[model samples]
Target: MARPKLPISATILVKNAQDTLQECLDSLQEFDEIILLDNGSSDDTLTIAREFNAIYGNLVIHTSEFIGFGALKNLAVSYARNDWILSIDSDEVLESTTLVRLKELFGTLDSKDLDSKTSESSALDSKNPKTPQTPTPPPNTLYALPRKNLYNGEWIKACGWYPDFVTRVFHKDYTRFNDNIVHESIMLPKDARLVRLDSGLKHYAYDNITHLLQKLQTYSSLWAEQNTHKSASPLKAIVRGGWSFVRNYFFKKGFLYGYKGFVISVCNALGVFFKYMKLYEATLPKKPRSCSLIITTYNQKERLALVLDSVRELAVLPTEVLIADDGSTEDTKALVESYARDFPCKLGHIWHEDRGFRLSAIRNAAIREAKGEYIIIIDGDMILHPFFVADHLAFATPKVFLQGSRVIVDSHTSESMLQARSEENAYKRVFTLGGLKARRCKILSHLVYATSRVDSKFFAQKDFIKGIRGCNMSFFKADCEAINGFNESFIGWGREDSEFVARFLFNGGALRRLKFAGIAYHIYHPENTRDMLESNHQIYLETIHTKAKFCRYGLKDL
Candidate 1:
C-alpha cells in the first residue's frame, strides 16, 4: 500500500541543471508537490524535468530570470502549492532514511508500541493495525538538517564538509532568505523555534576538478562584488588565505582525508584569497581613482591638440594623463609640454624611438611608466565625451575588461572641427558635427549615449574578440600585467587589440561591452597601413589555439 504524501512542496532554482535534476526530484516523490523554478536554462534540463513530471504528476515548473540567489529562492517558494516548503538544490537529494525521519517529525507516521507486541505476534496482526497519514507541523517552526557533501561519489568529511547544517524546511509566512548576491541565508524570525534534525541530505556537489574551480571563480567574484568597502586591501587576502589552509588542514583534520582533502583545503584557501583580492581590485577605482588615461598618438599635433582639448572637458579627471607617443617629432613633444603647465591633472608624454609602427611596444612602455592601479587606454584621434572618464570609472570591474562605443566625425566635418580657433570651439563641435556608422567605423552603440550606463552582452561571448577598440577600453592594471600587456611582436597596425583581449579571455578574464556610456568621437583619417595585418592575425589565431595566457614580449619585458 502507498503511504499518504507529506504536506510539503519542494522549491528549487534551476539553471542548466539537467545532470542532477532527475535524481533530485526522484527523492521528493512522497511530497505533495515539487516546484522547479528555471532561470534562463539553455540545456536539456526542461525536457528531463517534464519527463519526470509525466510519470509522477506532482512537479510544477515556473520560469524567471535570475535576480539573485536569495530572491530567486523566495520567488520559487511563492509558486509552490503548500506553505510547508522544502528548499533544495538541483545537486542535492533527500536520503531515504532521512525522508522517513522527516515524515515522523510531521507526525504523519505514528510509532506503534511494538515493544509490547513483539514476543508472540504474527508481526502483521489481524487486530489493531497502524494508520499512516500526513501531519501538520507546529506553527512558527523552522527545520535545519545536516547535509553530506560528496566529491567523486565519496563523502568528504573534512574541510568543513561534514554535518553541514542548513535550514531548508520553513513556513512561508514566518521566514524568507536574505537578498544577497552570494552566500544568502534564511532569516530567523523573532521567537521562532529552530529545530535541528538529524536527517541527512546528500549533495552531489562536485568531483570534476575543472568544474569545481569554475564555480569557485564565479562565487568569489560575486562575493567580492557584494562585499566592496573602502578598506579592502591585499593584506586581508594574504592573512585570510593563509589562515584558511592552516585551520582546515591542521585543525579541522582535512589532511587525514588524503589527497582529496588536501585539494579541498587548498581550494578553500584560494577561494577566500581571490574573494578578497578581487574586492581590492574593484574597490580601488571607486572614487576619483589614481587612474592613468593613456592616449596613444604619433605625429598628428593638430589633431592631438583637439583630443587634448576634449580631455580638458572630462567630468571626472584622471589622476595622471599620459600621451603614449609612437615616434612623433619634436613638435608633438612641445605641444604636450605646453599642456602640462596647468592641465587639469598631472600630464606627461611617454615617447619611444620612432620605429616603423610600433603601437604595441609604445603601449607597453606607457604601461610601465604609468602609476595607476586602473588604466584607461585610448587613441589620440578620438574626441572624448564629457562623462567618458566618469563612465569608465563607474564601469570598472575586477576581472573583466570593458570595450566601449565611439561616434565618428566625417572627413569634411573633421577638417572643419580641427581648424577651430579655440579649444572650446573644438569641444562644441563634438556633439554638433558627429555621425555614426558602427561597423564601417569599427564602433557599436555609438548613438546611445546617456548619463546612465548599461552593460550589453549582445556582443559579449566567451570566444568573441572582434570589433574591439583599443581606443576606448578599460582594465585593471593587475589584469594587464597578468596577460603581460599587448603582444609587441605585431610590428604594424592590425589585430593587436584583439590579440590582447584574446589572451585576457584565456587568462580567465571576461569581456563586458560598455554601452550607452563612455562615448568618444573618432576624427576621420585615412586608415592605417594594414601591411602587417595578415601576420598579426596569424598571431591572434595562435594565441586562441594555444590558449596563451600571456605574451612573451609585452609587459613582461617592461
Candidate 2:
C-alpha cells in the first residue's frame, strides 16, 4: 500500500550562528515549512534566514529575548505549524536521501502500525490523556540518526566518534529539551520505538584548539556550578587532577589522535583538575574533614619540599601526613621532621634499613602507623590540587576498593623525578602498564613490534585505558590491606601496582575509575623503565595466570 503524506516542519533555534545557518536552512528546503527561532544574533544569520524565506517561501522566522537553550528550543516548537517536527542544530547538514526516506516513512503509517511502534515513537502517548486521537502512525515513532562529527579538521573514525546516534527527528509534542547550560539535547521517554536511518548528520565540532579551549572553559565553569556544594582539598585536587590526564592519554587512547588527541586529552584532564581546584578555593572551611596522607620516599629529598608545600596548601587539611623513609641518604628524614615540627597535620616518619626500592613494602609500613580512617597514598614528588582529598571522599563508595584518576604533568615540572629519567618515559606511561586494566607486557611487546604503525596506535586507544600514572592514585586503608598491599614479590617499578589491582579485581574486589574526577599532572622526565621490559615481574605474570592465584603469601603475615 502507498503511504499517506503527513504535515511536518523543521524548527531550529539559533543565536550568533551566522557561519552555519545557511547550511541548516538550505537542507530544510524540501520540508513543508522551515521554522527558525533567532535569539538575537548580532551577525547576518537572521538576514540569511530571511533570504531563505524569500527564495523558498515556506520559511517562517521568529524572534525572542535571549533565553536559555532549553527554553529557546521549546519556544521554537510552539511556533511550529505542523505536529511532526524535525529539530536540527544550526551547524547540521542533512543528506537528501534522509529527507526522502523520512517523508516515505511518515506516509505508510496505519493504526496497527501505531500499536506495533507505540514503544518506539515518542508521539504515541497513552500516558497523556490530552493526546488527540490520530491516524495509524508509521511503524517506528522515533528515528535514530547517526552523526559523523568532524573534529580538529578531521573526521574521527576511531575512539567512539563515528556513527554516534541520537534521536533528533521526532514529534514535537513528545520531545522536550532538558534545562542545561551546555551540551543540551532533546529528551525522549524510554518506551519510544526507534528506527535507524541510513544517512547521518554532519557535526563540525570545534574547528581548532582555540575553539576547543573556549568550549572547555565554558563546560568546566558549568561543572563547577553544578557541583557547588562539594568542598575541595588541595592534596586531593592536585593528586587526582594529575591522574585524569594519565588515564586519558595512555589508558584511554587519547594519544592515538597524536598531537591533537594529546592536547584534547590534556584539556580533559585539566577540566577535572581545575574544576575541583576552583571549587576547593571557594568552598573549603577552616575545620576540614580529617583524613591521613601517606607518602613513602627513597632518596627523593630534593623534591620532597614541593610535595610538603602542596600538602600544606590543601584546601581541606588532613589529620596526619605519614612519611615512611626507605633509607634516603639525602636528608629525607631531616626534611620531613622539620615540617613535622611546624605543621598542623601530625607528621609521622618511619626509617628503615637501606633496602632496594621496595615501594610496596615501604607503603605497607606507613599504612601500619596511619591514624585517620581514610588513607591516601601519593608519590613524594607529587603536587596537590586544592580539592584532591575532598573529591575522593565525595564519590567514595564502600564496595569500591581502589579509586583513582589522572592529571596533567610531564618532565617539565621536576627534573629529579623518576618519570623523567629517560626519553620513553611519557610514551611508556601512556602506552604501557598505566590504566586500570589487565594488559600483559609480553603481549603488548609482541604486538607493538609486529603491527603496522597506524594499527598499533589505533588498537592502543580503543583497547586500553589512556591516562593512569603511578604517582597520582589512592585507595582506602582497609581495602589496601585486604589485597595484601601491592604484591611484595613483584619488586621494583612496573606491573606491581597494576598486578595488585588485577589481583584485587579477581578476588571480588572492584576498581573504581575516577576518569573525570580525581586528576593529576605528570612532570616530564626521561623514562626510567627500560629495564622493566625484562624484569622478574615479567616472569611473575605466568604464575598469576597459572592457578588463578593472585597475591603471594610472603607478606600475608605482615
Clashing residue pairs in candidate 1, if any? none
User: Candidate 2 on 1-558: residue-level lDDT in tens?
Assistant: 533434677888888888888887777776778788887789998889888889878788899885566677778888888877777889888865565555445563445445444223333223333222344343237666777766766766444455587677777767676765545677767767666665658777667878778877777776666567776777777777778778767776667888866776677677777778777765642222456788767777755666676667667777888887877874888888788888867888877777676776777677777776666777775555556666555544433433454444545335544434334232223222234332223344334323412212222234222333456556556666666666666555666665555555555555555443343444444455546535745644543454223465324654
Q: TM-score of the candidate numbered 2?
A: 0.43
Write down the RMSD of candidate 1 (Cα, Å): 20.2
Give a tens-digit lDDT track for model 1, residues 1-558: 566777888898899998888899999988889989999999999998899899988998999986889989989988877878889999999977667666665655434322222322212113323222337666577777678999888888888887698989988877889999889989987887776655559998786677779889999999988887545678989999999999999888998988888888888899989999999988774443579999999999888898888888888999899999999999999999999998989998999998789999999899999998889999999888888888788767667788887887788888888877364656557675433423222133333322222222222434444568898999889889998998998989999998888788767777777775787888889999889989888998787678788888897764
TM-score of each: 0.52, 0.43
TM-score of 1: 0.52
Residue 355 local lDDT, model 2: 68
Quality of model 2 by C-alpha lDDT: 0.63
Candidate with the greatest TM-score versus the true structure: 1
Q: Judge candidate 1 against the unseen true structure and give its global Cα lDDT, from 0 to 1.
A: 0.81
